[model samples]
Target chain A: MMTTETVNVQDEKKSAFLGSISSAFQGAETYATLRKSAWDTLSKFAIPGTKTEAWKYTRVGKVINHSWMKSHGNSQINLPEIAIGGLRYVFVDGLFRADLSDELTYPGLNIRRTGENAENNLLGTLSNHQGDWFEALNAAFFNDGLVIEVDKNAQIDRPVHLVFFTSEENTASFSRNVLSLQESSSLHVFTHYIGSEHSTFSSVVTEAFVGKNAALKIDKIQEGNETAFHHVDWTKQDRDSRFDITTVTLKSSWVRNDLNIRVAGENCHSSLTGAYLPSGKEHVDNHTMVDHMVPNCESDEKYKGIVRENATAVFNGKVFVRPDAQKTNAFQQNANIVLDDTATMFSKPELEIYADDVKCSHGSTTGQFDEEAVFYLRARGIGEVMARKLLVEAFLADVITTLSDERLQTYCTEKIQQLMHS
Target chain B: MLHIKDLHANIDGTEILKGLSLDIKPGEIHAIMGPNGSGKSTLASVLAGNEDYEITGGSVTFGDKDLLDLSTEDRAREGLFLAFQYPVEIPGVSNINFLRTAVNEIRQYKGEEPMSAGDFLKLVKERSALVELDGKLANRSVNEGFSGGEKKRNEVFQMAMLEPKLAILDETDSGLDIDALKIVAQGVNAMRSPERSFVVITHYQRLLDYIVPDFVHVLYKGKIVKSGSKELALELEARGYDWIKEEVSA
Candidate 1:
């Protein structure tokens, strides 16, 4: 009876905590009906515990137990220069900052703030909020975001750069974005997240649509400071379309990324690649899923990480092929290197194929540095530390080379080197 | 100059080199021929500071420094090179990049500036020609995907580039055809100078035909039992190692 009473009291406390967060944006004009329903779904479920199969290796107590205040826009902080030249957009505390951003006008592109486009129906269509705490939270309270639409048969020459800056203590922010590419269109996007040295939390959701014969590529870099970041990306590809994304996580206190891609049409191609380095008690988790709903589609995924100094990294990748998805080809691989004895890595690659005529493969590997390679390098007059560094760089070369932009590759490489020596 | 006095070493608590003694002067090539498991390669490993083998008792002096006290890389920076019988294949590390790093590191140890890019490339071109190494092979990963002959030639090419004071070739002529043997010998001969010395360790005397040695020594049961002029190698070749074993036991 005592245990039962304690469980009930804990449930009450969790409900009260979630209720307080939801009441902040009562009766908001952006997706009011959808937000109302999402909050209802969120209130029905408690925070996931360690027993949850999807989150067995990751602990979320640090994120859910805090009393976080909503972040207000702060436009006073200095912004760093953009690394690559492109049409740039800046978001501060989940609010778009036009003063710090480039001109939004460009050829063959339509860009708008969520508040400006009240008739847009693509915001809440792709991402599902049912039975998902983070998704529900993001959908119910996202204040403002960007909506991008590429014209039909248009080829955009310049890439789009989006920067999100958070500079507050004990605050939380939510943002949602949507990208729509018409038939035979092509575009590239780069996203960067920067945080100040204060305890903060942020959640971002992106819904993308790839039309027939369209091509879309995205590269993301996350640089965090005592921050808990949650990102969800839902992308749908049409017939003869191509979708590629590469995510590189440099630093963060805690991070959880969910990438879901659905092949809704035939002859579509999807490629996903990522590299992460976590040290100093940091925690990073990446969960990816690719669903094949039609015939004649291909999907490939590769993620690599280096864990050091008591850090933890978790990778779970799944590929699903439906009964009608005949002639589907899927491949997934996860590789990691644990640099310290105290470091931890959990990797699971799973495939669930219901189609009779499909080819699918998955692999996971976790290991330490090759001692023979180290000795060989040291034999050639290279120091012990430099030898290990060279080997680490070589191990990550393949993953980084998958990026389509050379400048982004160089930037990521330089950032990794800096973090390694730091 | 190199000197080894009463050297004793062990691997996994089993003795390999027992009370071995030798003296080598500059401008001299000494060939040490021995039967299988006769501790020829053990000497090379110990001199190169391989921690796998523990030196139980030994004193080695190389150019006025206690060679055994230094680390492996320090020994290399101090002008000692070893052309391993089986060169390591290090994928993803370009040959030119690795050599440049090595050259810069050695220069830094001697309080010198790094070599300019143009000068470094020129040096690479000039030295790689000594062994007739293909331009493509010179730019590829170190010893990766190379044939047996290419691997040996790469070792000699590295020896030429580093310009070490003393180089030990451990069974470098073992798996080479006649054509490859002549090319490897030519590369080594071109690097011979009064300021440099070579310790050529081989199981056969066929290599001695191209790169002539000043002296030949017979090592058996971890000890040098016979020392003579170059004719000793020929004698041992004509009459297999059985005669040397009998002579040592008698």
Candidate 2:
């Protein structure tokens, strides 16, 4: 008798949320059935709260109460350059722009829409894990997303850049990104998120699947107006696969990026690094999880942030080692530089290990610039501003060095400089 | 060129330099010898305008300007240099870039334009050779992973790049082999000119052998208790600071 009351309350909330999601996909012909099925699954699962182990530090309940289901129709918009120079893809209001994309072709690369029944495909199957609320939401309302596939043993010479642009104001955006890498294949992926000069909340979920012996390098840049809010969730990695991901966040009213990697095969490796330069009451949160489900897996995570003004930042990193996953090596470090006294950084690093013979270490540190170093620079006649900039550059150099792409590295450097000026 | 009148400074409620006074003119190198905790380093720091020390009482006049009123960087831009006793290592900033910034900052402060990249590189090469510093070391982070002697040498290289009017060497001779000592001293001696002055703070007379001083002052208990010619350094080295301490007590 008590269960009936709880079930009834849950059922009523689900139908309303589901109806909104279904209506958002009215014009899209390809994903109608998949959206219906995802909607049904989501109706059974409640939005996760902080009590969930994976969502402990991140409070998703606060985000659910907001009007996130509001749909943004086609609107006139202009996208700002992402400070990245390359072949770019521009998506305005979830519609791809042909003028911004190139028709050039490369060997061993295929970009096209999957079949109508691609709902049961490899990536779609993985997205059903735990029936994640955000994943379901993206699936139910995703208008158009590219399906990029790499051929086995093929090496992509140039890095592929994916740019997401939006101009809908006062509305939330739901977007999806799918990337798949074949065995022994190598590719570089750049995902740039740019918002129109408007205030809005943008929700994006990206699933990347790296096959055995495959290598993938990803660079994520998030730059938007300070009034903007963005949420990003990503999953998808395999055994003997190498995934290198780095994110640079410049400005956002509120930004949260969740990156989850499961190393299911032996000898897999992951290098995750993120740098955020937040100023003027901005906030940036980065949460990462690396699961060593198999033996002989390794991961190294380094995140750095330079917070000025009254900005706030959060970094939550967790590395999990299963009981059978012996011989796992994991290292994580988060260091922040607080320029102003009011700037604050919250860092939580956790290691959950059920396996023996594993090497894991995590550490976090937050502090102002070194007085001795500043004095040394000043003693050389360098002004206060330049001295602080030099120290900040030095602080971020190690993480930036973790990036192999020279173009991205230079671009990040210039962006950091500009952020300091701003 | 410089005058200190009854200079008294305190750090963390402890008075290190008490009523110290001295005078130096251009075309002269003055060596200040003292025992441990004798405030030799404090005098150099106070001269360079270190903000940590509170100047309870003192007047330091350099080239007709009140030295204590200026900030550390202002003092530096005004042609004052201090080769730290223990140089700080700033990781990930190339030595070349750091030196170039220092040079250009000083130049700009003097109302001169920044040096061109090529000219700056040329200056770096010339100054580095003066201290036996390898070009690769200049390209590496500032003093990062540098050996003890290499760190001291890097200090001299900076001194050369800035070419300040008043250079204070704070224990620059410490932690150096004989070869490094010679190279460092040669670099300092090469920069010597009638228009420049130096205040070398050291305990041992070994460094004075290479860079001969024109005047020698014995600092005792935060004050200069004895002043003499360069020969006084040999006497102090042979007899040690104990005799000087005894003389001050008497």
Candidate 3:
């Protein structure tokens, strides 16, 4: 009888999820075949449980099985000002807001909203059904997002900002963004995912193709309410492009970021830096993977986490060096600080190597703030609270200051200072 | 300027400093020489408000304020400084930035306006030179990647910057070479004034040759057992601490 009840619960969840996905894209002839195939592939793999190797540290069954995974809205909202000079694209509740966005007139750039009128199926081609249920779910259900293209040899003076804000409660939303760059092109994206202080589910899947010798940098930040759940982020880089991805999570109970960089061509350089603070029983999981597929490539990853007041954080960083990827130099480090004994952190930095010649080193450490350092500051007349804040900022400076743009770096610095105080 | 009477402190329920007493007057430089396990560092830590040590029974008054009632930072703002024997390495915190914050905080506590950027930078340039600290080193992380001599010099530099009324130097000459010791002593000597006092704690009398303490005290087994003039340090140095132990036992 118990076995029957457990099976019944899971079957009910599966049917409900599949039903929502099929109806959402039922009339979409553009991606009808792709959507069906993706759903079929995703149904083959069950949602990860505690027994799964990659999911052992982060049990996502509860997060994925939750009931709020269907509805989305297009309510207009006020967006917070972050940058001074930039091309802005605003989205409310996962739907683009044209009135709030800027009219594009810059050279060598083009952007269009995705719908049935769109010509390409890059979403299906760029995203594969990795055993990850989140990505697979995103592929099966994502309805609309923006497709950006940069011309060859053209450099955008200012950054391109994508602001996503959640206004409804107990609703799930997904956005699939695709960006392509031509040879020697360069672009910068300052992305934000913000939500109200309610239980909102949001998933954003970004697929980027960087051509030969092109460079791209994406600074993604998540600021949601403490009660919100259901967040998944994915990005893929290609060819000899220089790619740098920085993700900072300020508030959210459940978030999963799958940041993958593919060194497809030789002599490519990629870097990923993440800074997160999980407070008050919040949980933030980051799974970063960099695949060195070609020879003469280098990658560096740094992640910093602060687990405060019974909160928890999980960092699982993986680096893959293919057999042909010789002369690869990959380095990864994850440092965390748990404020009290109640707080917990799980760090699993993994390296899967098939190459013979590589200089790679990865390390992780989790501890409380250095008492001696705090006291050293205090002994110099810094107040106790100020001292703690200073040390916390100092701990996160490595990752926070890695933003290439000076303005973006200052923005992050000020945000970090506010977070430390809050 | 500072006074400690019947100071009894312990760590982890073990008695470390038992009924220790000391008095400091303005413009006085007193050197306390002691052997191992003699509570010299413990005294320094207790005076600096390190929480690891508990005062079971004691009375500490500094600048007419109850020293035991204030926190570590308040003690600092009240004109008490401790030059740590082992300075901690705080990475990513620029030395210049932290010193500026410390100075501003102290100034704020004293009802003074914040220093301007130009003035602060100028002060930093002048102070970093007192200990012969490298300009680049002073701009990097606090004490990070600093050598032993550099760390020691940083402590002295901080002391010069803070300009405490009563400064406690705990084993400042432990790992210094001859030249570093001379330079560090010069920094200390330069800060001496009629309104400033120092409590120099060390094992050897070699540092006294440069700083020239007016009085010398012997700390043995958590208490002071002997007191005399500056020549007492020379005699103890020439004879060694074993003779002091014998004298105390007798």
Candidate lDDT (C-alpha), each: 0.87, 0.80, 0.83
Q: Which stretches of candidate 1 lie over 4 Å from their true place?
A: A1-13, A25-27, A356-359, B235-239
* Model 3: how far residue A18 lies from native, Å: 3.3
Best prediction by DockQ: 3
Single out the weakest 10-residue window by summed lDDT for candidate 2 chain A.
A1-10
TM-score of every model versus the real structure: 0.93, 0.91, 0.95
Show where candidate 3 strays beyond 4 Å: A1-10, A20-26, A61-74, A226-239
List where candidate 2 sits over 4 angstroms from the true fold.
A1-65, A68-74, A82-85, A104-106, A113-120, A128-132, A226-240
lDDT of 1 by residue, B1-250 (tens): 8999999999999999999999999989999999999999999889988889999997999999999988888888889899988888877678998889888888898899999999999989998999999989989988889999999999999989899999999999999999999999999999999989999999999999998999999888889989999999999999989988988878
Q: Candidate 3 chain B — worst ten consecutive residues by lDDT sum?
A: B120-129
Q: How close is candidate 2 to the true structure, as a TM-score?
A: 0.91
On a 0 to 100 scale, what is the lDDT of residue A137 in model 1? 85
The DockQ of each candidate is: 0.60, 0.82, 0.88
TM (chain A), candidate 3:
0.92
**lDDT of candidate model 1 versus the reference:** 0.87
lDDT of 1 by residue, A350-400 (tens): 788999999999889999887777766676677777787777777777788
In candidate 3, how many Å is residue B246 off? 0.9
